[model samples]
Target: MIHLTLIIVDFLTGLLAAGAWALASAGGAIAALVGSGFVGFSLFRKWRRRQ
Candidate 1:
């Protein structure tokens, strides 16, 4: 019974770790996209001004 309980605890820990990793990954991706978009917009404005 103790072994089964330990197994369940380990599984829950692993699941939580995986969920945290996925959230971090998704957040990083969103940040990168936003950063790139801002950079692109700034560059476009500069180019337009020069023209």
Candidate 2:
């Protein structure tokens, strides 16, 4: 009845929320990896020039 519907809606909302969080976490991880790669490349180039 109405209670069952409410429970279903709540469960769907929770699932959607979890999916959004996971997507955000993945995006953050990608950004961090790209940032690190850029830093490492710049440092290596600078060091190479000095040698």
Candidate 3:
């Protein structure tokens, strides 16, 4: 019985870690996208001003 309980605990811990990793990966991607968009907009404005 104790062995089964330990296995269950281990599985839960692994699942939580995987979920956290996925969340971090998605967050990083979103941040990169937003950062690139902001940079592009800034450059576009600067170019338009010279027109």
The RMSD of every model to the true structure, in order and in angstroms, is 0.5, 0.8, 0.4
Query: For candidate 3, what is the TM-score?
Result: 0.97
Q: What is the C-alpha lDDT of each candidate?
A: 1.00, 1.00, 1.00
Q: Model 1 off-target regions past 4 Å?
A: none
**What TM-scores do the predictions have?**
0.96, 0.90, 0.97
The local distance difference test score of model 1 is 1.00
Please list all clashing residue pairs in model 2, or write none if there are none: none
Residues 1-51, model 1: lDDT tens digits: 999999999999999999999999999999999999999999999999999
What is the alpha-carbon RMSD of candidate 1 to the true structure? 0.5
Clashes of each: 0, 0, 0
> Candidate order by TM-score, highest to lowest?
3, 1, 2
Predicted structure 3: lDDT: 1.00
Assess the local accuracy of residue 42 in candidate 3 as a C-alpha lDDT between 0 and 100. 100
